[model samples]
Target: MGSATTHALAATSAALDAASGVDLDVATQLFTAARTLADSVQLRSALADGAAAPSARTAVINAVFAKEFAPSAVSLLNAAVEQRWSSDADLVAGIEELAVRAAVVADPSTDVEGELFWFSRIVADNPELELALGSRLGDASAKGTLVESLVDGKVSAATSLIISSIVRQPGERRVRAILTQALDIAARQRGRTVATVTTAHDLGASQIDRLRSALSARYRTDVSINVVIDAAVVGGLRVAIGDELIDASVSTRLADLRQRLAG
Candidate 1:
């Protein structure tokens, strides 16, 4: 990340921490504001331009979004725009990150990271569903409705809002990728790390707890595990935490052996 983007995120994080009584409503409003900023080139430029006075940028934000968003959301956005951004795109991404953080802050007890990971896996398992969500020609509203129908009661309200918004506005990436990013952001908001673990079979509750404990000890922070059962893994497990991967799966070992033998 650029210095500007990093600074902007830091400022926004502070704003979120200071805001009281934040809830899913604040998150939804922030997400809506993000979409609006993303859709308008002029607005994004005005807000993200570092050369412009911070007061001027905040004024622009108030003029456009003051009435549309809750007081907390407006305050957060104003603080975000007051910081410098690397680019217009970064400004939009920063807003999205704040939205995800708002959701995490609202309901810290919910397992949002796990929900996002499971939802992404569900989309990955169904090619048609994935295509429908990622298709550029599809209607945005219809895609959002489909997401809501699938997850409304099954997941937390925050998770549903995050999924629906991403499906409606995935930009240039696949639905699964966007969901994964959201999951990571939510985990970070809680000062935890997310480990994506793939195994040949579903792990028992005791086994998962043990793994979580071990990973937490290794990383020195709380670890959230998102399990994906794949028979192709063929025993053992593949664990990914951030950019680090610990591959103990039988398939990976066999592939490495085969490569070494060929060489």
Candidate 2:
């Protein structure tokens, strides 16, 4: 992991330590939402999309909490969305850590996203590194030693140990994927600004710039975008920012054309 990610995690950890004043019940509800959303891409996108207004986030709570959820919990969720996250993952991980910090011991050095991404990168970059790390040494000490030597002084001791431990965990699968999920959950807690644009084809650089600018103008804050290409769209674009979707796609047009023809 890079120094920057380490520092960010450390800072968040400190914030959590100091977050002692956040209402436990409220924190718990939000924390649960964060984790649940982390596990669901649809949920994360709905909450984080830039096209979605702040009210949309609250509406989600209202829709979700029909009766059982307290009003305060809903309010807290809205507040988190209003606060805004740099990116969906950034906020998701933030929430995860916040919840974890609430219930368990927190090591500031644990940058789940950073560590996971780096591990994946290492695996992609070097087959030897992957084998060495994934090697099934019956001895925990032996496995840990390999990790320490490979990653020590290279990454924080906390991050190195986490990778090593996770690698050797029995029946443990997809540590990186789980971390990615956690990152999404954390993003929810932090109130991430997410924008999604879908087109018949990948957007060009200019289109991306325009999209970003328009989204920022619409939200009055920086927006993060997730772009998807679908040939069915035919042409034009469909943009979803937050909860709002602007369906200006050729597929929508075709559908309308078909309806008109039927009429």
TM-score of each: 0.97, 0.38
By lDDT, who's the top model here? 1
Model 2's alpha-carbon lDDT is 0.57
Q: What would the per-residue lDDT of candidate 1 be over residues 1-263, giving only the tens digit for each residue?
A: 89989988999998899998799999999999888988899999999999999999999989998877888999999999999999999999999989999998998889999899889989999999999999989998899999999997899988998899878878898888999999999999999999999999999999999999999999999999988889998999999998999999999999999999999
Instruction: Report residue 213 deviation for candidate 2 (angstroms).
Output: 0.8
Off-target runs (Cα >4 Å) in candidate 1 are none
The Cα local distance difference test for each model comes to 0.92, 0.57
Ten contiguous residues with the weakest lDDT in model 1: 165-174
As a whole number from 0 to 100, the lDDT of residue 194 in candidate 2 is 58
Report how far off residue 75 is in candidate 2 (Å).
24
> Candidate 2, 148: how far from true, in Å?
17
lDDT of 2 by residue, 1-263 (tens): 44433454555555554453344454455556665666677876776666788788768767875365545555545545543555666556555455534323224434433444455556646777555555555554575577677777666444554455444432233444443333343333334455556787887788788988888888886665666667888999898765588999988988999999999
CA error at residue 183 for candidate 1, angstroms:
0.3
